[model samples]
Target: MQIDVLIDVKTTLGEGPLWDVQEQRLYWIDSVDGRVFRATADGSEIRAWQVPQKIGSMALRKNGGAIVALARGVHFLDLNTGDVELINDPEPNLKNNRLNDGKVDASGRFLFGSMDTLEDGPNGALYRLDADLTVHKLQDGIVVSNGPCWSPDGKTFYFSDTWSGEIWAYDYDVEMGSISNRRVFAVLQGENFRSSDGSTVDEEGGLWNAQVYEGKLVRYAPDGTIDRAIPMPVKNVTSVMFGGENLDTLFVTSMARPPLSRFPTDSVQGGSVFKITGLGVRGLPEHRFAG
Candidate 1:
C-alpha cells in the first residue's frame, strides 16, 4: 500500500472528512475549534471558515452545500459563504449531548447518532432523518456514536459505538431504510486498541475501520473475519472514506491533540489527512443526501 500525506494541518480534533466529487476537493472539520477546512486535491490551496457551533460530521448534499451535524442540530452549510441554515434539532432537550457521526443512506435518508459530551455514560442514540425531514429514532444508549455505512447492495448496514470496542451489522431494508437482526460483525481486540472509530466499505464489501488508539486500519471480510491490518502513522485515526476519480483512493483522517496524554505511536504528523493507493481495491462512491 502506498501512503501519501494529503494535508499536514494537525487539527486539534480533526473528526470529519468528506470528498466533494463535483469540485474534486476535500472538506473536513476540526470539532474542537468549530472550523471547517477545504483543500485542493494536491493540498496546494486551503481555505477555512468557522461554523456556528461545534461540527461533528457532515454529508454532501445532492442540491449543493453540506448537511452539517453540530451540538445544536442538523443544518445546511453553504460551503462558499460559511452560512448555516438550520434544518431541525432532533435533540433540543438534551443539553449535554451532541450529534457525533452520520451519513446518507441509499434511500436518500440521513442516519446519525448522538453522544454524551462527558464521555462517562451510555447516553447516545442513533436516528434516521428522511428526505421529507421526518426523523425516526433507531437505537439508543451509546457513548460515542460513529462509523455508519452500508454494503454495496444496500442489504447490510454497519455501525460502531466507539466506547463499546465493537462493530455491529444489521440486515438493511432498501426501500424502507430500516435495519434489523443486529449482530456482532467485528471486535477490536488488543491491549493497544481502544475503540473502533470511523469506517468505510470497499467495492468488495470489505469493512475498513480505523481503531482510535490502535493506530491501524482493520479491514474485515463480510463474515466477521480479519482480512488485513494496515498500520497508520498516528494513533488516533479518526475516519476513512473513499475518494478519487475512480474511488481507488482511501482517504484517512487523524487527530493531533487528543485529551489523552498517551499515544500508541510516536507519529509526528498526527493531525494530517492521508491517502492510500495501490491497495488493488476500489471503494464505492459516497452516497449523497438527497434532501
Candidate 2:
C-alpha cells in the first residue's frame, strides 16, 4: 500500500478520524486542543472549529452537525455556528474520569466509554446514548478506553482498554443496542507490544487498528489473527478510518506530544494526518448518530 501525509497540521494529541459517507468528507479531532477539523476526501477545503472542552471522539449526526464526546459530557456540536449543547453526563460524580473513544452503532445509537484521566485505576464505564436522548450504562471498571468498533455484520462489538493491553469482543444486539458475552479477542504481547488506539472494520470483517506507540497500522482477522502490519514513519500513530469516494483509502491520525506532561516527543511528522491507498480492501460506511 502507498502511504503519504494528507494534512500537516501539528496536533498535540490527534485522534478520532471520522469519514462521512453521504457528504464524502473527512473529519478528525485534536483531543487535547479541543478542535474539530473537516475537509473533503482529497484533503481540500479544510476547516476547523473550536469546541468548549477537550474532545474524546465524534460522530456525524443523521439530521445535521455532530455528536461529540467531550471531557465532561456528550454534546451536540453545531458545525455552522460552533455551538455546543450538553446532552448528559453519566458520571458527573466521577470527577477524575472522562469520555474517551466512541462509535455509532448499527441502529444509530452512540456507544462510548469513559477513562480514568490519571491512568491509575478502573474507574470508568461504557455508556450508550439512544435515539430518545437517554443514556444507559453498559460496562464498568475501565482504565483507559479506546477503539469502539463493530464487525461488518453488526453482531459483534470490539473495544479496547489501552492500559489493559487487550482488545475485547462482545455479542451485540443491533435492535436493542446492547452488548453481552464479552471475551478477549486479541492481546498485546511481545517486547514491542503496541497499545491499540482506534480501529475500523473492513467490508471483509478485518479490523484495522492504529498501534499508538509502535507506529504501525495492523489488521486483525475476524478470528483474531494478524493479517498484516504496516510500519509508519511517526512514532505516535493515534487513529484510523477509511474515507474516499469508494472508501478504499485508510486515513490515519497521529500525536505530536505525549498525553502526559512527563513525556517528551521528537518525531517531526508526529501530528500530521496520513492516508494509505492501494490496499485491495474497502470499508463499510460509518453509521450516523440517530439522535
TM-score of each: 0.95, 0.97
Candidate 2, lDDT over the whole model: 0.91
Looking at model 1, residue 69 earns an lDDT score of 87
Best prediction by TM-score: 2
Clashes of each: 0, 0
lDDT against the true structure, per candidate, is 0.85, 0.91
Q: Candidate 1, clashing residue pairs? A: none
Q: What does candidate 1's lDDT look like per residue over 3-83, in tens digits? A: 888989888778777777777877788877788888876776899989889878888888888888888888888987889
Kindly give the stretch of ten consecutive residues in candidate 2 with the minimal lDDT sum.
187-196
- List the candidate 1 regions with Cα displacement exceeding 4 Å: 260-266
The 10-residue segment with the lowest total lDDT in model 1: 258-267
The most accurate candidate by lDDT is: 2
Tell me the tens digit of each residue's lDDT in model 2 across 181-276.
999998765345447889999999999988887778889999999899898998789899998999999999999998876444648999999999
